[model samples]
Target: MEQLCDCDYEYDSEDQYTMPEFHQKYKDKLPLLVVVSGGFNGKTVYDEVSTNQVIWFHRVCQQSRVLGRLSNQAVRQYEEFVSIPVHSGHMFNVITSSRNESDPETLEDILTKHKLPVLVRLASEAYDYTLRTVKRYTILLLKTYTETFLQGNCLQDDILLPPPLLLAVSPDISVAIATGYVNKSKDTFHRKLRQISEFVKRNVELKEKEGCKEITLFDKQDSTTGTGNSIPPDLLPSYDEDFMYQDIEPDINWIPPIPPNPGFRPSLPARPPDGLLCQNDTPVDSEMESEKLSHKQSSDVSAGTFNSLTVYDDDESGYNSSAGSVKSYISDMSVEDIQSLLGALNLTKYKKDFRKHLIDGAMLEGLEETILREDFKFKHVEVIRLMKYIREGHMPKQ
Candidate 1:
C-alpha cells in the first residue's frame, strides 16, 4: 500500500518550473526606427537596438519572429543600462520608474547625448559562372551614401554624389580597384560602383538644370517636389550607330519543342492501360455507391471536428461574456488578418471616394488606451481611453 503524508506535496519538472524573475527594468515594446541599408552593418545596428528593447518592449509591441535571433550581449547591455527600480516583488515596475532626464543610468539620456546609433552598411555579391563582384561593392557605397545623406534631417536629389553610375561615362569616381572574394574573379566592381555614382550625379545635375529647384526626402524621378519633375530625362548614349536590343538578339533553336503529351495533357485525365486506380480494384464512377459513401463519411467527420471546435454550450458559464468578447476581438487583431482586411478594403469604390475625407475627419478617433503593468503605452489618445475604462464606475466624480 502507498503511504499517505499528512502534508500535501507537489513535484514540478525543471521545464515546468519557470525561473522566478527578480526584477524587470521596463515593460518590453518594439522600437520604431526604420533602418534600411544595402548591407549587413545597418542590420547589425537594428539587431542591437531590438535586442536591448525586447525584454521591455515585447510586452507592448508586436515583435516578429525575425527579432528573436538577437544575441545575449545586446540583451544584457540593455538590462544593465536600464536599471530596475527597487520595488516589492517586482523590480522594473513602471509605476516607480524615474522619469528625470538627469537620471544618469537611463538609456534615453545616453543615446540622445552620445548620438550613438552607428549606421553601417557592408557589401555582397552573388554568382556562379560570370564575375559579379560589383554587386558587393555597390552595397558598401550605398551605405556610405545613406550615412552622408542622414547627416541632414532629410535629402533630395540635391546632386547626390555617390549615386550609381557607369565607369566609362563617369570621370569623378575614385576607383580603388579590388578583386572579388573567394575566387579573384575578373571583375570591375569598384569601377562599376563609381560609374553608378556618376550616373546618379548626372541624373541630379539634369534635374538641377531643369526649371524645378526644390527636392524632398522621397524625391525620386516620378515623385519630385515641383509641378514638373526636378529630374531630367535620361539620354541614352548612342554607340557607333543607333542599335536596339532586338537588333543584337541571339537566335536559338536548341531543341524542337515537343508536341504536348497526348496522354497527360491538361485537357484529359491520365489512365493506365488496365484502367485500375490501384491493384485492388477498377476505377469507380462519381455516383458509385461505395465512393459516394466514403466521401460522405469523410465530409461528415470533418464537419463534426469543426463543429466541435466552434460550437460552445451556451449553458456552461466556463467563459463569461466579457472573456469571450475579449478573446474574439484579439483573435481578429493579428497583423496578417489586418493586412488581408486592408487589401479587401482597398479594392472597393468606397476607399477611392472617402479615403482622404476619412483621414481629415475625427470619425476615426480611437479609444484612449494605456499600457498596464504588462501592456504597451502607444499614445496619448490610447492612454485617455484606457484611463476612462479603468476609472469607469469605480467612483462618483464630485
Candidate 2:
C-alpha cells in the first residue's frame, strides 16, 4: 500500500510509524473525522495551479520547438497536446499517447504542414535551369500563399505565429510583432490585418486590370529601356576612338604672339638723294648734272668698300627692331597678363618666376630665347592675339 501511494506522498519525518502499522493499531479504536468548511476553495486553488502548469508546459514546448530541440513530429504532438482542453492531471496521459517510435519528420514536411508555400516553391523551383519557368512558378506560389493562409482566421489567439505568415498577411503586422506592439494590444493586430487584407485585394485587382497574369521574379532582359535581353545603350560605355579621343584647342586669347623669325627680314625701300628732290623744281643743267655725278660717285664708293658693312648694319637694325617690339609688348603687360598667357600656352612650369622676372623689367630677348629653346612653335600673330586677350582679362574659348 505504501509503495502504491508513495509516488504522490510526502512525509515530515522518516522515522514515523508506517501507514499499514498505524492503521492496524487504530482499527479497534473509534475513528476521528475533522470537518472542513468551504470545499469549493480547494477546487478553485487546484484549478488555478493546474492552469498555471499548463501555461508553463505550453511555453516550454514552444521554446523547445523554436530552438530546434524538438523534432517536427514532436512539435506536432506537443501542439496537439496543448490544444486539448485538459486539466494537469491528464497531461501525462496526453504526452504518453503523442509519443511515437517512427523517424523524425523532415523540414519539408514541417514547412508544408505550416502552409509555407514560399519555401516550398523555392525548393521546387530550384531544379529548373530556365529563369522564366522558375520565375513563373515562384510568383504563382507567392500569389497562392498570399491568397490562402494570409487572408483570414488562420492565426491562434495565444500562439505566436511565424514571421513569414505575418509578412504575407501584412508588413505592418510583421513590424508590429517584431517591435512587441502586437503583444501589447490585440486591437492593433486586428487593425493591421484588416489593412493588409484590403491592400492585398486592391493589389490583386490592379494586377488583373493591368492584364498581369503572372509577375516576373527574375528578368533576363533590361526593363528600363524596353530593349532586348542585353545591356542598355546608355549603360554600356564606349571604348571607341571617337569617344575616347578629345581635341584640345589651343587658347588663342591667352597665348603669347610668336616672334618673327630672326633669320628673315624685309628689305627697306630706298629714299631719293636729298639734292635730287630739291633740284626737281629747277632746270639748271650743269648743277643738276654735277649733283648726279656726285651721287653716282658716292654710290660707287659705297658699293665697292662698305657693302658688307651695310649688310651687317641692316641685320643689326632688323634684330634690334624685333627685340624692341617684343620688349615693348612685355613692358606693357601686367603680371596677371603674363601669367595667363603662360598658362594658356601650357608653358606654366616657370610661370611664377618668369612673371616676376618680366614685371622686374627683364629683357624680352632672354624670354624669347627661353621660349624658343622650350620648343614652343606658335606663330607670331597667334602669340600677339593671345597676349591681347590676356591684357583684356578674357580667356579665349577653346
| Candidate of highest lDDT | 2
lDDT of 2: 0.28
lDDT of 1 at 195: 49
Whole-model lDDT values for every prediction: 0.21, 0.28
User: How would you encode candidate 2's per-residue C-alpha lDDT over 290-310 as one tens digit per residue?
Assistant: 677668656855664222224
Error of 2 at 26 (Å): 99
Pull out the clashing pairs in model 2: 253-386, 256-383, 257-383, 257-384, 258-380
lDDT of 1 at 395: 17
lDDT (10s digit) by residue, model 1, range 34-127: 1111111111111111111101011121110000011111111221100111111211111111121222222222223433221111111224
Minimum summed lDDT over a 10-residue window in model 1 is located at: 140-149
- RMSD (Å) per prediction: 33.1, 35.4
Q: What would you estimate as the lDDT of candidate 1? A: 0.21
Judge candidate 2 at residue 168 and give its lDDT: 17
